[model samples]
Target: MSTQRVFVARLSGCFVFDPAGDRLGKVRDVVVIFRKDDPPRVIGLVVEIPGRRHVFVSIGRVTSIATGQVITTGLINVRRFQQRGGEVRVMAELLGRKVYLNDGSGTAVIEDVAIERNRLGEWDVGQLFLRRPRTSASPFAKGPTTFASWSDVREQQNPGEAQSAEQLVATYSDLKPADLANTLLDLPEDRLIEVAEELPDDRLADALEEMPEEEQVHILEALGDERAADILDAMEPDDAADLLGQLPEERSEELLDLMEPEEAEDVRALLKYGPDTAGGLMTSEPIVLSADATVAEALALIRRHELHPALAAAVFVTLPPYETPTGRLLGTVHFQRMLRYPPHERLGAIIDDTLDPMPAAASAAEVARLLASYNLVSVPVVDQAHRLVGAVSIDDVLDYLLPDDWRSHDGEPPAASAHPTTATIPRRR
Candidate 1:
């Protein structure tokens, strides 16, 4: 094997020439085997044969790696390359991942990794070429490129190595879920799955909710059954139901079976209603307390950090049992009402019964009008028996009222301004 040092990025896409200087194939992927105690070792190259298919070229045959070209022995393996356990691909896996500087003052995305062989003939990551994130006023202007020794950067954890999705996401943790979702969309399927697997279920759920329905389904399918189900359980029941409704019945049922029974039951109920109905747009989980519960209890429920803002706008008070579809609707206590009343005041005393709940079969148009006319952020959904079943949120109503491709368009308007400054425009003009 050649002992020449070369940046994996430069080698990628470079044409391979035989000893006689005849063009053979272009480098498609650089293969490496990762080890804990030493750097990942480069093993071979996956090259795309001109008129044929991809084939494996052993590093041992390479005579030299120079700018834009790889000179190798005429001998080549005709077999197609298949990645096995412990093998990592540089261009496919590492190039686009975000990496932090060891000093923590700056960060750069791995544009390419440099690989070189030691005296012992083992390949190692020798250096890294980084592309700093763009912050210029002109979108087309390129960002500065900087080089760093592989050792000067934070550890680059390969997939199936130590599960670095969390580390990768943690670097962007300051970003809102929607912003994070945009970045995740740029990744390839396999890389997307690896990163999604490491994200906390709640975070993944939030990000998935912000993505387009097609993209959402794509990620969920890539997530596999168990992990996908866990993320669904963490999402708002209405959003979870919407996604499930888009999937095939068998796959939906499999995911539902994997979810926590309580959460699954709520989503199942939503699924029973047509996508155009009020019930389908409502989240089954909301702050529901007994009519006799104290103001302090209502305050505590509203303060729970996990409650979605729309759901937390008000606390629904119900009679007996306090379970969806079982409890009789009493009234709702707006968050402001809880704040106005003394902690010892009974919730029943402050319940606002002036506003009536919408029937489960109410059309989306009707739901929208009701919320708008009442200037309500959320309204309860009730069945024929007048039992409280769920609450339709303003966001959910908007989702139904907007055009089907509303999320796909760029710069028309933002769906949710939860973090306005961080919202990404789908394209640059």
Candidate 2:
């Protein structure tokens, strides 16, 4: 069967199907190995399966690459896809690369790459779609975009040339925070900082929350004080407090001072608890509702795209002052139970008060036990006055219970030599 040339950008979201016509997952990226004398050869594909897990599909297993679909030989490697030393992720690492045209027309940014099957039944990068910068006289005008054979261009020679992350950020724009964080971890420090600077405050904050404390501190410090504080203001109160706890008291205080008063207050409250306690693991912004709230209202609030799945599994009912440290801890309403009740029924009527709320000072093990024993996605934490202080989600418990360096063990090995002169930022004193 003859295969037509395909542009990687067009294949980014195309679905992959097995020979049996069973849908597998969407193509997240194409992996290729660059060679010194020959064009880069396509090696495999990164397919994002359910749960946002990325797996590898060898190029040889791909029977066909048609419009809107990719048919595989049904044999796949379920292990997580780990990028090796010489392997390059076309979309993630190559899309925004700077290259010089052979004609000496100055530098152009790579916008897309085209791959075609060779006579030997192998896929190779054959063409490059690039955009040259507009002339200085017309700086405001868009640049001219053109296609050139892969061999007609060479990588930018100057080692100090500034890299722009606009295309790199665009490539991973649709990724979830956790998946985006994983991708960011693979980037060199300089590239990571560039991408972080280009990302929106909220998007960066979400990804930061999913990263390890060390990476979080590195990125937070790399960003200046103002930008760092803005990102903190956008992160969940619990996650912000946890990251701040890793810094010196003085530095932590300085950042908190720069955050918005309301946001800082929540973080400050969480900081008062022991790092391994329930309060420390609880998010100050859980789904809270008044006792008089209707089931329909509860469902609507949880349905919001912004709410985390674990946090949305249940609603906490309070007497009044619906925010954290709410008037009084009333009871909880599981989403499953809410569905069985009439839409107009008050939350109070379906409250599940059987399981007692965990104390703010409860140990990490105690919180885990409560969640496991009760099979609860989240459990409320209360102070001595029996007021709702916050709630701990299963994800929070897992982050604490897992090994400190667990994030570093995700299949990808360390490559210190890959980036010899990475930009360094001093840790907080």
Candidate 3:
């Protein structure tokens, strides 16, 4: 169900080739090439060949990759690639560069370089896979591997040059939001902070929301108050409140002063509620629209805003003052249901009236009951005024009630001791 990607460590040793099925060789090393003044990119892969020569392949010209093999089509041959001056880049030089594979389709980090044996009894690169793997069953956080796997990448090129630790941090841009979330959690704290600083603000917020609360603290704490405030400014109001609530109250006031008044006030509103209560768990952002507009206009808003179709599927179509967050709540319109109507149909004409909604002040247990009944990962929360206040996600409830229950259902044996955990809940807030 999660579209999360893995780290590039998994795709370290894929085979390589050009047109005509001419075997070029496998990736020997990967090198990241960021600006001398900036972080390194794991952008180049050093290829090993049958002859005494090697070449570095860029993200371009990468046609496709299957398992451990890289497929590319080009006018030039392997011989010309070597003569172009990329002989010295071995896997030892590119430890932490970013790799923007396949013309920047996605991103990934270099975790480790793996080597395997070829059919001729000679050692060759095998697969360039991403590092981290995720499952809903894992404890509140994910497990680890320094080198990422290829599956974590949304797109990738053939055998990329191997990297050595001394080279610099590698960045891969080919991952989806969820994938980036897992990778961030899996990365070492220092490395994760660097990636977090580079991520787009909205995306950084989404990834943080999907992340376990513990990791949210680790990354923010590492960034210190100044940097953390910059990222928090871009997060949804409720999410920002939730994150701020996890820190010591003394630190909260200092951070509040650092935020803009509007952003600060939105977070303060949610901070007033107990974390386990529905009010504490609602999100303050929504793609709301007037209920009287033509269905066409409402649909246009969704596309223009680039909102998640699932979250904005049913526009909370209200009445009047389309420009302002208003007081009237006329009704709701399912995006698909609206699309089926004639282009001239009004939103109110096509609205459904049978939906049951929850109040913001309800306990999570009550909200869960509704979610279970409706099979929803998220549910809207409205205030005493009937206006939408926030939304709650399934993970929030599970964290409070079933952190360890899932492991029992999974029939997992006693956990390995690499990561120790406490049974008694800590009183932090």
TM value for model 3: 0.56
Tens-digit per-residue lDDT, 24-100, candidate 3: 56654444432333223334455544432344455344555445666655322232133122322323333444455
**Which one is best on TM-score?**
2
The 0-to-1 C-alpha lDDT of every candidate, in the order given, reads 0.77, 0.87, 0.56
What's the C-alpha lDDT at position 3 in model 1?
Answer: 64
Ranking by lDDT: 2, 1, 3
Model 1 has an lDDT value of 0.77
Residue 248, candidate 3: alpha-carbon lDDT: 94
TM-score winner between candidates 2 and 3: 2
Q: Name every residue pair that clashes in candidate 2.
A: none
Which candidate tops lDDT? 2
Candidate 3: where is the Cα deviation over 4 Å? 1-93, 96-170, 304-306, 319-326, 375-378, 393-429
C-alpha TM-score for every candidate: 0.62, 0.80, 0.56
Off by over 4 Å in 2: 1-3, 12-88, 100-107, 132-144, 154-160, 408-429
* Model 3 weakest 10-residue run by lDDT: 420-429
Alpha carbon deviation, residue 88, candidate 1 (Å)? 17
Supply the global lDDT for candidate 2.
Answer: 0.87
